[model samples]
Target chain A: MKKLLLAAALSALATGAAWADTVRLGTEGAYPPYNFINDKGEVDGFERELGDEICKRAALDCTWVTNEWDSIIPNLVSSNYDAIIAGMSVTAERDEVIDFTNEYIPPSPSGYVGLAGGSVDVAKGIIAAQINTIQAGHVASSGATLVEFASPDETVAAVKNGEADAVLADKDFLAPIVAESGGMLAFIADDVSIGGGVALGLRESDGELKAKMNTAIDAMKADGTLNTMLVKWFKDAAPQW
Target chain B: MFEICAEPRSLEGLTWLSCYLTTPKHAAMYYSILTVLGLLLAVVPPILFLGFAGALARRSKIAPVRWLGVGYTSIVRGVPDIVFFLFFPIALDQAVEYIRHKIKCADVLEPVYQGNDFVVCQAAKMPLGIADQFYHEAWGFSLAVITFAIVFGAFTANTLHGALNAVPKGQLETARAFGMSERQTFWRVHMPQMWVYALPGLSNLWMILIKATPLLFLLGVKDIVYWAKELGGMKTQVYTYAHPDWRIWYFGALLVFYLFLTWVSQRAFDRIFARASRGLSVAS
Candidate 1:
């Protein structure tokens, strides 16, 4: 029994050592198109496909891990995962804590969705945005009453419930919702482009891994596979290389 | 689900609500109630065992054992439960990872702490990075259970200690005069009597435990509170079952659910209290 226990422990250690070589990709599975949990309960969306392709191109073993969006960056820094591919927009504030590979998806505009025909002055009226997003930062600095929610769904709900005059979020995210709202929702203001493009977030110490991923992203861009995925997921809004 | 649920946006009134209440997300919400109940049921045995051991340790003749028990109860009871709830899981997670990092990455020379980051090798992750989603969820739920047990066990210890003392000294003396061993006297006279005094405090603790199930959200377990906030928020036409901001109704449902739990708990405790107090000379 003692010998068998020792053997089991040794094998467990061996497996743990093997796991060290695999890069873990952390993502927020709540956001659709970028990343979302499909009905099958696996991470399935644009980023999931892109991340898998990037791993294959880099010849690196990788695994997907879902994390809540609020702690995605902190968790990455804390070694909860090797990199973040959670549709995170590159911002100077974020770059202070972690490094980013070159942007895979270009800057998408942020737009305000509101009840159709409502007089929502974007500069002064109450606006809702997901907490810790570029839109929330913009609204907070723009002198509007910014109501921040933890999820994108709640921001839209805020607009519909009359809790806020409008909700500012990614145009790609809001456009589909607005179109499908049956005229109950519409763009209330001009789109505002903020932050750099979306990129994979990595810890500052993981420069080798970042370089490997950046090379993979560049390869995809050069081969047009990247553009095809963008077009498939974002449709007309996709910024082709 | 009804056929009208196929085009949920087209329906209104009771039909829409009927369909809305049974969406997959709502179903998940309903299942989360079981998560709360499971936590309660799983936690009780550990709590009672810990409480019993703690009370006995405090009553021990050995000085160090008594101090150990006293220290455990006092330190845990002194801190607010919310603070413990927030701190324990993160600290425990990091501690586990830190030990794993030491064992798994012995060859790595770099220190684990670099500035604000608690950098550990990928192998040191609590659930291996490649593990399925169910494993991750189970790991988090397990951590939540341990945390609840530790915090609530301390309170239970203090209550049990007091109840042990509340058992009459004269009854124990009579048992001793009849030549009963100390162990026999405790089991026959003291332990049975201790329950009557302990029941009131235990009942209060149980009610608090039920209410504290909502705090599982803070620990990142998808308990009912997490689902309530997620499902109750307004879903737009992009969703299959679009709804207006119905958070009030969703939270209202949660309100009723919690009230029902406490109401049932109150009746159950009352029956237990009456049964325990039976044939005793103590005033009802």
Candidate 2:
């Protein structure tokens, strides 16, 4: 009877492992082009498409989860999600906490979009950006205030509220903020940009999962799926890198 | 022989520091932030009072009053503050404009909500068409204060209502037997005693209010958090004091400032607690 009970427990564990197909993914849904929520409350944009493609390639069924940007890393550490597909930039500090797949989107020029004013020459001074942007590294010497925020919305709101003179964001993301500024703010020259591009990440413990993602990303780039989605979101101003 | 204050140096350390600190515009902003903090402190009290009324109404004998009070507190608590901070200012601004739109542009026939855009007659703009930049700032501050008050007030009301019920029922009965009116008894006996019970909760609410001042940046008021970020970034060759990324230091200073504020408030609350409990002695 004891042998029969032990066998039953092993079989139950195997069945549970076989039936699990869910891959919880997390992202800051407020950022556009990378990831954003549409008016209909559905998550869409480049990151979603990339995540779906990667899941298909890896043969893992996945669902994307919206999480606060500051909490994303901690949540992953706590096993809240198996993966993060947010437009997270790879940096030495963040790399210390999580393992990232190889460079997917390369660096793009980053700068601020603000109102046309003598108070801020977006070309000249301190700036604000979503936390963890490469533009932060470049603008460190610009003598301009570098206000870091968790969401693209907060960065843009900083501009609107006049708390931030300008924002350091992708040229694509800045376009919406500029348009919405309603003449209160405008973008400086786009030639003065900073930041490499975004990346998908996972907890460092998940080394095997990282390898599968790199394979999927390579397939997406090779098959032109990445470029197609890039054009759909970025349009004429898409980063060439 | 050393020169003793004979030739004025182009920009000495003290002179540069003095000029930077004394700049007229900078001075104005220094005082302006204090005004903003004062505005915040001044505006929050009425909200607490309103919240108390709402909580009492929710606990009222009348069903409708109780439902209204319950609905207000629960709905505010349910939604994330980010949503309320985003929604309230815009909603209030639009609501005010709609009223003005009716008054000033009654003949206009275009619908207000037109495909994600809210269009109102130019004449209906709050503060009218000719207001200056300062007017806009004042209006924004007003909106922020109201939003903070409303949100925090609900929490205060919940605290106060609990304190009200905790008052010993025998005290009220004695007051009634002595021919005191209900209103007089509430003011003379119940209200004064409620503070003793309410102090702990009220003190916690004060800390929440203090920590929440940073959210004023979200509302568009340039409080110290905004300035700290602005001043703390590295300046290049163009500026006199060039440096590297110094945001960590700036944020560190802000953390200290907040910590100090909390510490001072905690000390003050302890004194008040002791003073309130002066006559009563617990077993040593």
Candidate 3:
């Protein structure tokens, strides 16, 4: 125990850190391309790899914790974890509650997808969107009847079940489903951009930790690593910042 | 699982079925079901003990003690258990932090409950902001368990109190005629007779507790319901073992599991009731 305390002290002394003894990286661990748990029950995805790299470059000892997306930010304020590496986009509403590092992945607008030969109109039809998402916010004001689900996949299911005429989500999240559906579905309308790009969420009080993570993110963008990771995860649709 | 499960496309019929059932997430789901059973085993004994104390307290001669016991039983019985289960953990956590806030940051305190937010000082944070990841989970789970215990304990008290009254008055009178002390007669005769009456009610409580285990998911513990959603979602090629949405099948399996569990409990309770009421004239 004394040795463990010494190790913590030495790390704190090395980093000149003012926060905690160890960094806890929180993520939803359910959203794909950004964060998700592998079959091994460990977090594995773009955000997991990116978070590790950031932690390494920042010289911080980090651990990962999985939380549901709905209460992710509130839990952060409650001090359940130090940072959220989940795919949360930076929005003015969210910014009021928490700070974000500079965009890690640039703004990727959402698109509406529906069945082919269907009477769905993005402007007037019943739309399905994941609750608390930018797409949901867009639909709320689009003059379209909106149905919200807990997860992104549920919105797609809603479209398939004829519960809604279309679903609005990140094209990256929807593209695989559209392809896997064997030409049953197609994009109904153009993309709608809402919030700024995804970034690591941090407590507003942790300015020093935020600075450290921003430096790591900026370095990845400067090098080709960030783009490579985007291509590796999001494939051909990888957005260039 | 069949050896042919190595190729997802090559497999067909039962081979595919076997392979699909043995996925890591499926294994985790199985373990999560057992976690509910484990919680019942861990929680039931303490709940029963609390019930016994409350029952005895209700029978106490002292006015305040009897009032405490009566209030506990009545208040909990009057409300739904799930309401308490949902309400207590967050309320208790906030109550703890509020007390700590009052004690620790007594000087420069702003209003803690500000509009929609509960803004306590960093020092007043339960498990603290800097505590380890495991510490946070442990704190949340302990709160859940306490909530479960407090709610079930009240019901158990009510049942045990009823059983105490249902015990034949002649048994106590006989003990008194034999020159036995009040405490001795209550412990030796009344307690044994009370068990025969209590067995049916306690078994019913056990079944309800079994059903309530699934609510652990709502309290933030990664139980069976959480795993069902996680494993049953559609998996794209990005995942190691890609599959279409199979949530219906997963939840169907859970349905069968709960059916079997309740069946086993019913059979076990019948045997226990028969044994407890052996050589007794009670209509249990």
Candidate 4:
């Protein structure tokens, strides 16, 4: 009886190892449209839908994991998840540590939003951006005093409370706030085109997984499903193929 | 979790709140309260053990042992707790990975610290690259516990050391005059009398430890404070549970939780102090 019990436990462990093969996709669930935790508390947004479709097309079992924005890249490298589909923009500095799949979302303009009727001198005034983002890197180098925030919401909050002269972020993310602010917030400066577009980030060591994801992304692009998703999530602000 | 939760945007009143509080994310927040308690329970044994060890070492006859204990208590107590909380976990993680890299990747020629990155072979990861998610979380939590133990242990050492001295010198001298060895007197007499003096300081330390649980979020443990911030942020119509910024309400809830915990702790400590101080004339 003891031997039989040991065998049963060993079989259970084997099945557990097999079930661990599912690919895990990581995202920051705080950013809306790109990603956000819905009322059901599941990861829901453009990236969520796109990641699921890609997994289905590639014939791979996948699960979602939420991580803080600042540590997203490090966590991916440390193998916390198989991929980062958190609307991360492709940049040369990031390319050194991790590899990227082909672009899923086209390059979009980043705009500065400030209080209505206020003039923001982009060159000299303090601008807010989420830390470790391409926009933050741009703000830091664009001759502006950059105040970095941990979350995207804090950047917008900084602008509303007059802690910053303006908050610069992706136009798609900023557009909805501008529309809903009742004329309290408006675009204060010309949009700046930055980054090489957004894509799925993967560990450099995971070549096979990277190839499979790239194939699925290409299939989505070819069938216009990716474009449909972009429009649905970003409305008219989405840059199309 | 309920059928009505399917359309959260349409939710209203108590029904909406029930669904809101029962979401998976909210469930995680509820579980994090237990995480804070678990850390407190798990840390106490190590803290007391280290405190006793440190206090004894300082009283050692050997000069080196005495210096080691003195250095530990003085150095750790001198640094700000927040700096130690932030620095220890990352430094310890890298140190573990670095040692593993040296052993597992002996043939690799590139340095471990290249430019800004700490590159290690996939096999050298602390939990191993293919380990389960449960292992990853457990690893983070264990690191948080150790950091807490180390910082709190130093303060505990100082309190225990003071208590050891505060045990009236006449009592220990009387034991020595009765032909008792120093070790026998320390274990049987001095240790028993030391508790009366230690209870007050230890109670203060316990309250501080309870308050420090919120800092677990800094070490990436997903404690209650992290969830409060995430759930309280503004949500637009695109989200299922659309709500305005409700951070004030969430923070208010945290305030009540902390006050209740401290209140319960205070009552328990009062009882323990009363019982321990029984025949002694020490103020309760």
Worst 10 residues of 1 chain B by lDDT: B233-242
Ranking by lDDT: 4, 1, 3, 2
Error of 3 at A60 (Å): 1.6
Supply the TM-score for candidate 4. 0.86
DockQ ranking, best first: 1, 4, 3, 2
State every prediction's TM-score relative to the real structure. Answer: 0.84, 0.54, 0.84, 0.86
- What lDDT is obtained when candidate 4 is compared to the true structure? 0.86
Model 4, A1-241: lDDT tens digits are 9999988964553332323347879999888889998766689999999999999999988888788898888777756577999889999999999899999998889999999998889889999999999999999999999999999988988888889999999998889878878799999899999998999998877778889999999999999999999999999888887
In model 2, state the lDDT of residue B219: 57
Best by lDDT: 4
TM-score of chain B for predicted candidate 4: 0.96
- Across B7-56, the per-residue lDDT of candidate 3 in tens digits comes to 75566778766776786757878888777877877787779888998898
Compared with the true structure, what per-residue lDDT tens digits does model 4 show for residues B1-284?
Answer: 78888877677899888988888888988989999899999999999988988888898889999999999999999999889986788789889888877876799887776544566755566665456666777888999989988888999999999999998888899999999997899988888889889988999999999999988877778888888988888777786666767888999999999999999999999898888777876444
- The best candidate by DockQ is 1
- Residue-wise C-alpha lDDT for candidate 1, range B31-122, written one tens digit per residue: 89999999999999989988888888899999999999999899988999888987888889899989988987898888888766678766
Highest-scoring model, TM-score: 4
Task: For all candidates, state DockQ relative to the true structure.
Answer: 0.32, 0.02, 0.27, 0.28
> Over the stretch A1-241, how does candidate 3's per-residue lDDT look in tens digits?
9999988964553343244546789998877867887766788999999999999999987899887777788777655677988888899999888888999989997888999778777889999998887889999999999999887777888888899999998888788778778788888788888888999988777778899999999999999899999999998988975
Give the docking tier of candidate 2.
Answer: incorrect
Cα deviation at B5, candidate 1, in Å, is 11
